[model samples]
Target: MTTMIKTVDVTTALSDVDRFCDIPNARISGEIFHRQDIYEQELEKVFARCWLFVAHESQFKKAGDYIATTMGEDDVIVVRQKDGSHRAFINACPHRGNKVCFSESGNARGFICNYHGWSFDIAGNLIGQHESGIYENSHFDASKWGLREVALIDSYKGLLFANFDADAPSLKEYLGPMAWYFDALFDNQEGGTEFVGGCIRSTMDCNWKIAAENFVGDILHAGWTHDSAARAMLGGAVAKVSDFDESYSVNWHGHGYEFAMDTVGNVAVLGESALNKYLHTIKPSVAERLGDFRSNMIGSVSSATIFPNFSFLPGQNTIRVWQPRGPNKIELYTWVLVNKSAPEEIKEKWRKGAMMTFSPTGVFEMDDGENWEYCTKTARGKVTAKQDLYVGLGQESLLQETDLPANVYSGQLNEANSRAFYQFWSDLLKAPSWNDVPNRNVGRVEAGAAAERCSLKEAK
Candidate 1:
């Protein structure tokens, strides 16, 4: 059952979205990350309209295993059903504003509200209550008061996603050619990928988009921000500093991926472990399944963001969600995704490696959070908010001349993906309804073609 979501009116925020992101000029105002008005509009335009990743299917190994997570500002519950299928619902209790499930995640047959004894079954059905309840009217039907279900829920491979809008496109449609890249990372494993560790939650003083955009194509910072960690690990003063090649891709609907041209630099963990051996072992099988293009990415170090907030490091085996808390803060949820058939030692190595590099206590993670915090904090100044940040690193160069699903750039350090990301954000805000979202699914091709023409003109 779909219930209407209550949202704050955002008339001014809609107008500001277009003003903040001027793609042709290569400018995005500082206010987009600092202002409360734009944040409110984002919840309506971006979060509500887009299909957001919720929980991985591997998280629920048995019936009734559920993960309580956040979709946007709203709380959500994703539960494995009696059958193998999965369903997601708003975690809010329908009777009152009280929570039905207090824990973040666990196995549960049913959820009983602590404030009142009103209970709901695993399928979100109103099962019991009324022995001592106030709404005990004999004629009133309690069965009709089930928990509010999300309008749409679907899976791509093993990843589950949910959308609030009933009119939004299907998951496969929204994913588009981005699915091709996903298969390279996810479908390559023999037994497939599964979350092998617990979650690590932390909050940082930064806009959600800042972190999301960084993973897309901001590899330039690795050498600078993670200089110390790189020296300690790779014995090099610079992080991921490669003499070989690297590439960036901007898939439709703002999804992105970047990987080094060489695979060794991406997965330079300890000397030679089972993970390294596993990488070599899977290449032939992956090549047969996905052909030469995708199999190249089997064990390569790559960073990607699935549109809005979901991100994963394929080499590191870390997956994360940058959950938006407000204009200036985000609650980050991280988990380890490892090969299903891997041995216990290999899985443990991946888990511990993620903790050392990407978790809250991670050395590299600490460096990144510091940069993002200051990036957001500095924009709080009135004059700073008026400034236009430059995001035009390879703006004149065309990255679309490719047979792959995503538009590929020559260099990994380019900001082409960031440009596509902000444009997608602004377009979603400018659209009055999902029907009016012209810049999304169908427009990316035309946009790429236009970029190609502009590049040719510049060369002439």
Candidate 2:
């Protein structure tokens, strides 16, 4: 008989999540941050079904370079192949439960498990086992026990993503309209981007979603959260974000990206006069390579979360993954991405800038961590868990019909992106299987149709 653990009914809890995150009433139930059972369910349903960031291709400079990371709660090894493709494997020795790859990242010939002298190749094939004579009469099959490969792995530009559910849609399809904005950051230059610095990881007592949300469309927090840094740095033009109120986007998937339309917007946040100067110097080339809209975004400040937990600051060039530990903890891995062909000095400047703005001890990062930690703690009480938290800013009338790939809103200060994120979050939880999830194609079609109508009405 299957064990049916009970307390807060699982079905009822999921239904509540769906009911709360809907449009016209986009609210978040605090229990989402507090419930242990819900967190366990998310490990299987949400993480397993989603396309999650594993590693970047630039990290695989050589044939054997590999990074050991996580896909949701499961540890994974992302390795570069000799033929220029990538593979991800569950990081466990099939013989016993010991992790095969010990190091975070390095070029490896193969992995040898310390627990039982089991050896595996670069592609995760179990090649050797110690004391062959001891298992002569016992039934053990080496061929049947390679490190179990992750179901699917793919890359867009240089960012690698993996999904455990074989039936889930392709990474591009799952990304939906978010790809348009991603290209603005990734493919808008003459040469592509690469991860520059080594990883900076630190733990925080906050849910992964909290950090993801802050990055997505929480521009409202900037002038307040990083107020001191902005005042102290006072890099002339960078200080102008005090008046920012401009553009933001909401992807069909649960992704959120917000940016000020001001040309010097992003670099100003770093209090780095160098980035502002460099951006203006490269605008002509950026325009020629990526065309108008993307070129326009070149010097503008931007932040985005590629739903679930992968995020990046386009201006500052910081890319981070919020690796979930449990209901109230996460291990954050961050790296700085710069144009592969950028000057060494320019790249070095970005490294120092990222360190100042987002590294573990960085000012802005510390401020955001404090808020997320308290948000998680607040939900521990029964009364607070049931209270509906309002997140519906500009929900009913914010989205505007635009030429942009994703549905966009008119202002930088909006919560529509957060709403879309939570809506998709709810959909994934209630979806019985990948096939059962709501058809996003229909939503996109309807959204386009609505945009066209709005455009025609405005013309009249």
Candidate 3:
């Protein structure tokens, strides 16, 4: 039986959404994190319409190779065709609605339905049927019965994404100023970066936003939350330094970043010979291409979130996609990123670092997972859910429009980014379309001028 969801008054929700901008130093109500109705609303208003990261193009290297991925809760299969082009569509077979391909990843010229012998080409055309006579003289056009395609699909520097809303902005436009930072991380090297093998998949009993917010906004927790792990990995001076505060910045469209000094020198953790070799290989090239500031960040520790649900810590060489299963659960897809032109030994070391720091078995992952689960459990309580949670760490200190690149933050410990994320989140849940977002909250101050400089209108 289908459960009926009562329609929320969009106008009333719009008022609530606009209020988030004014509540700079206030706590957000905890109810937003646990309500089932709100989660349902998010599925339609946010997830369905947003440009979600699907998979890297490198994942589909050869023609016929494909990987099953998720956009919101919808299952999609991304395939590389004989012509070396790519396509993505709902994984369901049109005839019987059965999942056409069950494997997580593989190579296939076409997907054959297991229930009935209906088959679809990698391009999503229903080309074959077991019993052609079943339809007889009936007017059935196989062309009209092709697998459903995602309304909007595009890529950015090899990363593919799809949106259910056709009117949504192009992927590049949606990425906005975040692209500058992405180019810093991805395009600095000659061949750029590529995912190593497949992702490490795991499930967490926590709200998806909890994990995303942690990556995007909660740098303060690193020292305390991962104290034991940091101590175990690098003892004495490194452990002591890890306890110190860091600096953070918030970008428009809810993207944010937190940067910290090398608590342990790069040479100490990555080995002297290896660090020397890496510097020798990239220093001259980096200086020639991106200048000193970006080249310097190559080995530093930085965690960042790209609006909505994609995040990466380039210094750690880790990338994550948070797939919300429901309000109380999330499926995390983690990939190890390696400089495409790095020496095999260096790439291997980077992979090991990623596994040790963020994989499901990693010490830090265990620490954060426990906290995420506890947060969700606490929110389940009637009294607790009624209260609000604070995220106003350095609201007064947030950088207003300045000469620095887009909302350049002054400190590493501010909650300005977290607040920006929630502000966008609330706006998304309320507005009927992405175009309506700017007008609904026009007077609201945007800390990072990044959005204005890299307008989504130009992404296409």
Candidate 4:
């Protein structure tokens, strides 16, 4: 017999958004991370309504190529058609609920359900049925039986995303000022960036937010947490890189940046000479494409989260999609990114760099995984679940109506990003539409002035 799990009343729990929002210096309520009811609520409020990253354009190159992916745990097949447009549909058969396409990815003219031979074209049109005679007078319409389509789908610099809610804002609008940083990476060159190959998949017993928060806000962990790995590679001079002595920027949509020293601790593996050579080689190209400001960012270490579940570490060149398996479990998919126009040798070096630092087997990823697991386990205890967690490190330093182009956080080690993330989370949970997100913190047009002053001071 199938077991039935209890459903959580997220609407009722969300009524206390202010309670969760008020405690900036403590852990969020432990119950929020592990409650079954809250997880279901997230499926509706967070997953269903938000734009979710699905696949890279590079994955579907051919006219009939397709890839099976997911958006908030719902299976979807992204297809490239002869008309040069892309489309996505729920991978379930219309006749029955069986998954129509099972392969992870490949070229295909159409999908034929293994269950009953029901087929759909590249555009998700019901083109063929095994038995049309039986349904001739049964009031069956092929058009009506097509695979269910996602309400919204779009691409930005080759990254494809979808949303189930029709009323959500355009993907570009949703990305907000964070696009400036992405332009530094994705649109740095003429052809833009592309996924080098398939992604690395892994699972962990921890709250998905823990992993997301680490990627978005935890710049403090690199030095001490990965100290052993950094020391082994650097011959014990990891402090030059991992020390959090830099500025922070928290964007309006909860996307944020931690700008720290260029000497990432992991680069110790490449040695100073090799590391210097690598930087020298990429510097001119980066400057030519993105100008001096972004070129300077090339060496800085960063951890960025795009709202709910998408995150990318541009310094490490790793793109991650976090799929929530439960309140306390997450399935992670990671991809390595490379400039499409980069030299083969440079691409290879970047790949090696990524594999050594960010993959499932990478030293830093393992360190992060351990902490996430421990945090989740502790939060699940009865006493712990009742208490609130803290995140108010830079609350006082938040420049609410600043002249910066982005929401600037004061310190590298501050929790401003985490706080912004939870703020958006609570807002999303309560608001009925994405349009309801307040435009209270849009940044000024002249953002880099303060950053430029700091750069000059450092030079002096």
- Cα lDDT listed for each candidate: 0.77, 0.77, 0.71, 0.73
lDDT (10s digit) by residue, model 3, range 1-460: 1111123223324335433233455567666667787777777877777888888877877988998988878898888878877777888887779999898899998888988888888788888788877765688778878788777778887778878777777787676655665655677777767888578999998988888888886777876787667666666434333354644464657777766544223333433346446755676676456554455545555677887789887556678998989888999999977778887877777778767778898878899999998898888888887776888877777566543344556666777778778877877876877767753224443333543343332232
The residue pairs found clashing in candidate 3 are 173-459, 246-412, 247-411, 247-412, 248-411, 248-412, 407-448, 407-449
Candidate 1 residue runs with Cα over 4 Å from true position: 1-13, 132-138, 237-242, 269-273, 440-460
Ranking by lDDT: 1, 2, 4, 3
Candidate 3 stretches with Cα past 4 Å from truth are: 1-25, 239-248, 261-281, 400-402, 439-460
> Could you estimate the TM-score for every candidate?
0.91, 0.90, 0.87, 0.89
Alpha-carbon RMSD, candidate 4: 5.2
lDDT comparing candidate 3 with the true structure:
0.71
| Cα TM-score of candidate 2 | 0.90
lDDT of 4 by residue, 1-460 (tens): 1011112223433666666555445447777778777787788788887888988888877898887888777888888879877878888987887998898889988889988888888888888777867777888777778888877889999999888777778897788666666665677677888888677889999988888888788877776797788777567665543245555555556777766545333333534445446655776677676555566565566678887898887656789988999888889899988778877776677777778877888877898899998888887788887776878776677765543446776667778888788778877777766666665565453445544453354345
User: How does candidate 3 fare on TM-score?
Assistant: 0.87
Residue 340 of model 1 has an lDDT of 84
